[model samples]
Target: MKTWSSIILAGGMSRRMGSSKALLEINVQTMVELLVEVLTPFSRKIIIVSNEKDYEYISSLFQQALHVQIVTDDPLYQGEGPLAGIYTGMKELQDSWYFVCACDMVKLHPNYLVGLQERLHTEIVTKRQQYDAFIPYSEGRVQPLAGLYSQQKETIKKLLDQNKHRITEWLTHMNYYRIEPSEWQGWTPISDVFFNMNKPEDYLQICRERGK
Candidate 1:
């Protein structure tokens, strides 16, 4: 029930995939299009961060939606990875909370956000400590791209200025609430919900699995 904006990181080089993952089509919808569709209901604004070349094309895709904004990574932090993407998105929108996702994720589970919101509300009711981020831990790793973040642009900027661009590394400096398997497994299996395509074969595998 908190004010939420959505940020989709779409600027990866996609070197392994051999093309822009954001532009990849599933059935008829591009990855970004699918993400936008799923996120619209929960977001007041949706920001897609791509590189310079993809900016115009992505912008054209969402011209009719006033709440969606397509942007290029900031000139200073361009190509710096997911941390830069997160900073660019948080900088673009002033919303208090942001649901950040990677464009490569094929089947993002909306229930994750719904459950996280409920947990946050419970914390408020019980007067428990809160955190700057609500991240998921799956397969023994933290999924920062699938996390919800508080406005931490300054923290991100400081880290990037110091030449630290890894998102997992940046998380160490923030107070975060980690959602483990026990907390999220009831909604959906983490593997299915957070399956990200890193190569052509991964895409093919996902398509085959989904009967696409």
Candidate 2:
């Protein structure tokens, strides 16, 4: 298995949820904790990007998980959105590839991730293509956070430098391999893996679905 690093974007204000979604409990685990658990087995390092105020609290929460690191948004890109958080993680690890996701994601399918890794290997090693990212496109939308990225720290920096915080816009400037819905639909229901809670109602809905 190739080495991989993971980045969890948890810096959002959670205005709609009225609280920190990262701290929300699901199946007896905090959102970030569950995400860390999922990534720990496959990741060499897992970075949680949040505000500086959350550094100590998040660090304490993951004390037993030594491989996990918590970081504040880069000063220049504070509150810039998921794109900035992604860039911060890329800078910290400087790894060849990254598996990025949002803190509110309730279920992450490991089988799908494995498939993405295999696809990435084929493109970069077998086919000798220079793709900057491997992202999933589902439900007529591009899921940038639930995607794998190449070492495009510089490219991201350029975007942030230009005050461009939109992830989709960043993709346009790079050579990316997009996994369409047709490619991933058979493995599992895409909605389950990509489910994210953006509001209190969404959280309640997840709780209901999970029989919590």
Q: Whose lDDT is greatest here?
A: 1
Residue pairs with backbone atoms closer than 3 Å in model 2 (clashes):
none
Measured by TM-score, the strongest candidate is 1
Q: Which regions in candidate 1 have their CA more than 4 angstroms from the true location?
A: 189-191
- Residue 134 C-alpha lDDT in model 1: 87
The alpha-carbon deviation from the true structure for residue 186 of candidate 1, after best TM-score superposition, in angstroms, is 1.2
**Model 2 misses residue 176 by how many Å?**
0.8
Give candidate 2's error at residue 65 in angstroms: 1.5
After superposition, candidate 2 runs with Cα above 4 Å error: none
TM-score to true structure, per model: 0.94, 0.94
lDDT of candidate 1 over 62-180, digit per residue (tens)? 98999899888888999999899999999988888899999999888777667777776676688678788888888879988888899999999999999998887788888898899
RMSD of 2: 1.5
Q: How many clashes in each candidate? A: 0, 0
